[model samples]
Target: MGSVLGDLLPLAVGVAISPIPIIGAILMLLGKHARTTSIGFAIGWLGGIVIATTIFVLVGGAFGDSDSTVGAWIKLVLGVLLLAEGIREWRARGGEHSTPKWMAAIDEMKPLTALGLGFALAAINPKNLMMCIAAGVTIGAAALSAGSNIVLVIVFALLAATTVVIPVVAYQIAAQRLRDPLDRLKVWLEANNKTVMATLILVIGIVLIGKGISGLA
Candidate 1:
């Protein structure tokens, strides 16, 4: 179990350092309904990760071969997907630069809307989906006890959502002092988002590809 969690840590951190979601949460914290809406978003974000990863884990368990071939193949396909997305983002970084349009909508969002957006970003975003798939396959391939697997999934989800939760808590504690720092952080994240994501995704993709090929051999 320690080995499994160790292996999953980088991917979990990948999700944690996701600039867009972190920036989005920060923006929500700056809004009028900061506490209520940010809490909703955090819960939805955590639930999205847990639910998506759990589904993949279960599906993999049901259909995966005893030899772990299915897990290896899934990793191969997801790796290729990540590599392609990394290349796309890398190319886009050179073009006309602007803040993501969605950031503009954050202030106007209600708690329910924020919840749905959080779920969509965590569950459907290509980078996050790939990470979840990799984590799910890693855990499923290990054939750990059901109880251990559930705990690991929950832990992974919580770790991934930490970036979102922390800012909300900080704002609740010292909303005045945090406002400036959080705003500056949001600006920097928006500015360098592409380069950061592209680099991380490319590295993870290459690693996953190597792991997949090694497993097959």
Candidate 2:
């Protein structure tokens, strides 16, 4: 269980620090319907992470043993894809950073819509989805007991949703006090999004590759 958690920590952090979702949460908090929208978004985000990771863990479990060659190959492939994505992000770092069309509509979004958006970003977004899949594969392949799997999934989901949850909860506690800071954070995240993602993905990709190699050996 400890080793499994070790493998999952970086992947959870990868999902946690995703700038776009964090930015979206900030936008929701700063919007007129801050409380409902942010809460909905947080719930959706947590649910998405849990669902996606759980599904992948099941898939990984179906692949036979934890240390199977097939699992190692899957990790290797995922690592390569992540590495490629990181390089692409690095190359595009200086490109114009525009507000996504969806973000522009945040102020007008209903609670349900906010929930769906949060889910989509966490489950459907390629980068986040990849990390979740990797984490799932790690957990699933570990062949842990059912209780252990549940615990790991919960841990992963919480860690992944922490960034989105914090802003929402904090705003609920002290709405006015968080306004300026959230805005500043949103701006910094927007500006440095590419660089941060590039660095993060590259490091995780390398780690996955190493793990895959070691497992195969």
In terms of lDDT, the best-performing candidate is 2
Each model's TM-score, in the order given?
Answer: 0.94, 0.97
What root-mean-square deviation over C-alphas does model 2 reach? 1.1
| Candidate 2 Cα deviation (angstroms), residue 119 | 0.5
Clashes of each: 0, 0
Query: Which has the greatest TM-score?
Result: 2
Report the C-alpha displacement of residue 163, candidate 1, in angstroms. 1.1
TM-score of 2: 0.97
Question: lDDT of all the models against the reference?
Answer: 0.84, 0.91
Candidate 2 lDDT by residue in tens digits, 1-217: 9989989999999999988899999999989899999999999999999999999999888874734777788888889999999999999999986778999999999999999999999999999999999999888888888899999999999998999998898888999999999999988998899999999999998998988898799
Q: Candidate 2 — which residues are off by over 4 angstroms?
A: none
Q: How many backbone clashes does candidate 2 have?
A: 0
